[model samples]
Target: MEYRKLKDQDQDGDTNEEDVESLRGKAISGVSLKPLAAFGVSSSDRSKWKRKTIVTFALTILTSSQAILIVWSKRAGKYEYSVTTANFMVETLKCALSLAALARIWKTEGVTEDNRLSTTLNEVIVYPIPAFLYLIKNLLQYYIFAYVNAPGYQILKNLNIISTGVLYRIILKRELSEIQWAAFVLLCAGCTTAQLNSNSDRVLETPVQGWIMAIVMALLSGFAGVYTEAIMKKRPSRNINVQNFWLYIFGMIFNAIAIVIQDFDAVANKGFFHGYSLITTLMILNHALSGIAVSMVMKYADNIVKVYSTSVAMLLTAVVSVFLFRFHLSLAFFLGSTVVSVSVYLHSIGKPRR
Candidate 1:
């Protein structure tokens, strides 16, 4: 298959040219045609390739759709609820689900019980540190969300890349390339443009505090990723599932305590069991998925790539928020976000594989 594709590429020397023209024709005709001839795919393998592409594209669309829904929910007047309680409950549920998932994977994969437990414990212990930081960040974020709109929060979130880059250099002794730095700058500019032109006013009273909290949250998340990578490097054989399980366990405990203390007034004001809605449920699920995604990336990919991917996620989040949530965008945001995305992608490609 590979040889045939290479041969075809060499022979035609204009495969791209042909493909572009074919695509244009297809667009103009607006009729169904065989995939094989359309893109020079061999008829014998066209079905397989079509299926693979469709599946991959479907999954991407699904994931992005879920993200869009979550962001929209936040914008649709869901921030009125108490952050601490909501996050604590969500984290707790996620931790429990993660533990269950690890157990099932261990059983199926035939991993040693002792190793699983040890790895699980490591996850439990380490997760809280970042969770604590995340909790702080989320609280600030929710506050910001309450004050500003989705676009502003999305833009500010790009600060994570900058924060992560600095922390990685300090903690992991990892240096980013010029391209990576350029991407970070672009992402920052995009975020700034989005925020500056936002119709929502900063309201001076809370914007500064929110900004401080958001930056702190970004720094904490960055450090958490670096720390998790360090831990994973030391235990290369450990399953990511086990590591994530323990991290969530520890995070749950810490977050639970913080929630109780910080939201004491809200709990009293709204009663201990307020705001248990579908939105909260979805938010918890989102947090769980995020934890799983981060752990898997840290375990399997280069740490630099892992951090850079976060920037990609941010950019995607912003774009989705704008289009789906009807958030505003500006030229500065376009140019800046483009720079950040390119820089991050370049850095990821340039990174040495483990």
Candidate 2:
């Protein structure tokens, strides 16, 4: 969904601009030099980098898996569920799991009950903004699924990197070199190549409506991501558990509202579980779990890691898609893919700004 694509984090939004500048430099340098991410930090910071790396890899897998499942479910046919219902269930489950996590943290850490409620409330007050963004993003992505296939979805989705970079410059007042811009351009080109030139099946020839949704999703994801990162940097000490709980609570609430608005008629006419299946349940669970994984990565890592992970996931999705979607490859797809890979690698390993 657009939620994963957006990299949106709910709760907490503050940052020491000076520290952000310092850390941003390191994040980019580390990413470029090691092609791993955030390596410019000293040994003292290695622990954090390690934490981020593990989270990045995990989220990458989870994110890609969710994409795979969505396409797989679509192809399976003879079974489906309301997109709104699925999104609502996922958010509800996510919120419940977050509450469970909060309970465990409270028990293990011996925090007082009153303080916990206060923490959660604090997060709710701040996170609703991004949570609402998530509401729209989630709905948009579901609509996108109706029009585009999995591989096309993945390729077009990588455009989020370009969106992120543009937002980074405008919102954070950061500057990028020509080289950095070129890499972003290369990513766009590769995704376009895969989408346009692929002799692949129906997924590649997404309708104009689908293209519009994907582009809008990318731009929204970019804005939402930068906003979330800024919030985390602003308040470095915020409790992630508290933040996540409120984030999903708001998300669940918003999705419920959307359901009432959009699905109420259909649901009342046909009943809520009319098209329910084990696959739908699994997809709901998949979305809920993947949401947590992404939030972790977005909080612990930076754009470099997130983009790299998303890029890798896109590649995997495209490769696996050939078998799953039964589409043939094209030369332009391979050429574009190679160019994208090389560009991302070179940019990551490029010399850090003086």
Candidate 3:
């Protein structure tokens, strides 16, 4: 009789313990049984997804609301003091506060020595790049705002979304669905409508240098988002408290450099120790709160969703700018903004439930 090893079966000829253990190990180790599935989400699921849908909707609303509030607070006239000097001061203070917050969290949580040092280095290296870029961006934005009004600035800034989307697709190989693409197009249309001939009355003949600087600023903001996302993914479980703590430390370093370069005289005249203007105070609070909000949201939500939420805020700002500032509101502006809003809504709808 040919002694064939009878397929590791039990006495009843069922699959034996060895076979069962092997299968379990594969599952436990993340070896998928289904080859065709993407991101481990099977196509067969239908009734199982109701909870995810509800949760995503709730999170989206929360994210959009927070963004709107932050934008409003930042744009409020009280926070719009002399843009360059005030922004540098605000960023410097924000960095200081953020580092303090991080240290408090670290002391409470008792991080490992290795983790502590790594976290410190993260802040040291990453914070300043974005801070300086953002300072420059804000400076250019205010310069533009001085000439063209808030509505125009809001419209132009929406172009950041376009740039971001392109970068994501090209650099990250993240693919968007057809609906998402349509949403982006609609957003562009809305922004165009919102800005079309909106600045006819007050053309300040803004220097080409300013326009270049503004575009650079917008690009930096987009790149910052991408870079932050990348960093978070690399260490998914890293505490936001620690990350933000380091962020502030590095931010302070860069902001200090910026202050010296841009506001040395202002600091000397006002006394470096007593430079707490009302605008600077609001900005510090704004940065601290907004940083926390953004870090938490990014932890739970998709990057694209976060980006789109800013679109909603931009739309609100455009509306507020027209009515509150009494800026021009032509038909083109209205139509474009409407299209962009619709696109944003559609994009929000199509976002995958986390």
Q: Give the whole-model CA lDDT for all candidates, comma-separated.
A: 0.53, 0.64, 0.50
Q: Of models 1 and 2, which has the larger lDDT? A: 2
Candidate 2 residue lDDT tens string, 83-174: 67666777777777766766665666667543264654454566777666656666686688888866567667666778888888788676
Candidate 2 vs candidate 3: the TM-score winner is 2
Q: How well does candidate 2 score on lDDT at residue 17?
A: 12
Q: Which residue pairs clash within candidate 1? A: 123-246, 123-247, 124-246, 124-247, 183-340, 186-336
Instruction: List the candidates ranked by TM-score, beginning with the highest.
Output: 2, 1, 3
Q: Which stretches of candidate 3 lie over 4 Å from their true place?
A: 1-85, 92-128, 132-155, 200-217, 273-280, 318-334, 351-354
TM-score of each: 0.64, 0.74, 0.61
Candidate 1 wrongly placed segments (more than 4 Å): 1-67, 74-76, 111-115, 118-128, 132-157, 198-218, 265-272, 321-328, 352-354
Q: Which segments of candidate 2 are over 4 A away from where they belong?
A: 1-43, 112-117, 120-124, 134-159, 174-177, 198-217, 322-327
Question: By lDDT, highest first, what's the ranking?
Answer: 2, 1, 3
Candidate 3, 1-354: lDDT as tens digits: 000000000000000001112222344456343554545766444212332233234334443343334444446433323333443443445445545554654676666643363645544565455445555554564466554445445445556777677766775567787788878867766765656673643434555665665467567666766655554445655554445555555555655676687667766776564544554554444434444445444444445655655455545655665665565666776677678768877876776444
> What is the Cα-based lDDT of residue 313 in candidate 1?
51
Model 1 C-alpha RMSD to native: 13.5
Steric overlap count per candidate? 6, 6, 8
* lDDT accuracy of residue 326 in candidate 2: 76
